[model samples]
Target: MEKQILLQVEGLSISFAQYTKGLRRRNLQVIRDLGLTVRSGEITAVVGSSGSGKSLLAHGILGLLPYNASMSGEILYKGQELTGRLLENVRGREIVLVPQSVSYLDPLMKVGNQVRKGRKTAGALERCRELLARYGLPPDTESRYPFELSGGMIRRVLISTALMEEPELVIADEPTPGLDLTAAKRVMGHFREIADEGTGVLLITHDLELALEVADRIAVFYAGTTLEEMEASAFQREETLLHPYSQALYRAMPQHGFQPLAGTQPYAGDSYEGCVFAPRCPYRGEECSIQEIPYREVRGRKVRCIRPELAEMSGSPGKMDRSPDAENLALTERGRMA
Candidate 1:
């Protein structure tokens, strides 16, 4: 069966207006021309450094940007544009956010009441129990307040609260920050289970390694925009990856060489032409900094680099599959050739 596109974001730009030293106002754009699609039954992980606007993307999608923040983008949910009344209606119902911080939990409200959102019905009570139990929260957890629970427990409670409603799309922003390895893996596994049940999960995380483990697709965010989006399997080898920054991430992984990339990402307010990554990219040419680089498709993936082919020519062995299906065909062909 063909997968349904649950959420689609196109040309998303978010900027905040602020006063400078002399009280002069300026607009600082954080996210620009960002685009990605989340399909039902799939986990699409957006991985990037902490300050790369990943959280802003989540807030933008949920229509939760502050009053001073100006946003321009087309956010479509179930093929309909999510704006005005539509966004307000589904902000917390259809599309739920598992925020990065557990501080979202109410300090005064009890765990059960908070999870059920004050519903006293038997079904609500039962579901609250099940969700809490599923996350290893004890039965007595319902009676406790947010301050009484551990940080990891509070994180689990936040997840349980989000699951209280059958949300069609789940935007999890750094949901595993305070969780231990086992707990984090378990949480990610639960997300996998949620997606398998036909809910679209947009996982916003800085943990590329963890994202690669469970996400079907991964979108690499950088300098407030997506640099590469491809199948998770494509990250098996650096050569299989397209963008240089993505390759850098692959090398930075512990299993790889743990080699850190030189230079820092450009700040949001700093103005410069060309690719935001040109200053650090090894394959960057003069043209890369002359103009704004357009995101384009290359080898069955979306990449923003001007020279994606250089990764393929970097002397790494083995050919990459165009898609998951193509990977199987390539393997079969290789077997036959042998």
Candidate 2:
């Protein structure tokens, strides 16, 4: 049976108003035309490098963007528009966020109070203890403050807190950064358990390999946009991935020669005429510079490249010349300075 769509985002764009030199105001377009779907009982991993707008997507969904930020797009929850009062109502109840930073936890509050959200009832305490214990945290951990816990313990605490509420959708932003390999895998296992029990999980992380371990679908995020989205199994082989950036990521893995992708991602406000990844793409062509690259389905996979076919014609794995040319180097430096 097909799982129900829990969350749907379409044409999502986010821009922040910033004052330039001499008080000149400009809009820094951080995320552009991003879209993804999360189905109930499935985990959708939005994988990317840092500053790829993964965390911003979570903040935008919960209406937690900064005051100067402006968002224009459709965010739907269970077939209904999620905005204004509706968004506020579901912000931390039906929809929960496992924030990236441990600073999100109150430093002054004890773990028990924080996890149960200030509810002092006996049932809430019992539930909190159970949740913490489920994540390998001991019962005595409840009396300690966030500052007292180690990084890995704090990460587990955040997950335990998010699970305190029976949320329909859980948006976890880089939830395993501070954890050891064993702890990270354990945390991912918990997410899989929830997904198995019908909770839609949108996992935001830069660790592509870790995401592949538990995610049902993988959405490859580039500079402020989605480059490709496909099944996690597509990552098993480079050819299965449709986009050059996705293939490059697969090749960069430790098991796949660790071939570094050259050139830097464009800054938030940098202008792009066509595909953003063209500077680092081995299969880049002249048409990539001028043609409008639309996010479309190519050979049953969703991709955002005009010349995805070129990847196949290029050659065997690890053979593509990814060395940066003079032009690409100049462009990368310009993007960094921007």
Quantify all predictions' global Cα lDDT against the true fold: 0.84, 0.85
lDDT of 1 by residue, 285-322 (tens): 89999988888888877899888887668834222213
For model 2, the run of ten residues with the poorest summed lDDT = 329-338
In order of listing, the candidates' clash counts read: 0, 0
Candidate 2 structure quality by residue, lDDT tens digits, 1-338? 87899998888999999999999999999999888889999999998777667799999999999999999999999999999888988888999999887799988999888999999889888899889888888889999988999888888888888888889999999888768888889888888998998999999988888899999999988898999888899999887788888887777787987666667788899998888888777777888988778888788767899878888565366666556363355433223211
Per-prediction TM-score: 0.91, 0.93
Candidate 2: list runs displaced more than 4 Å: 313-315, 323-338
Candidate 2's displacement at residue 284, Å, is: 2.0
Q: Can you list the residue pairs that collide in candidate 1?
A: none
Worst 10 contiguous positions by lDDT, candidate 1 = 329-338
For candidate 2, give the lDDT of residue 19.
Answer: 95
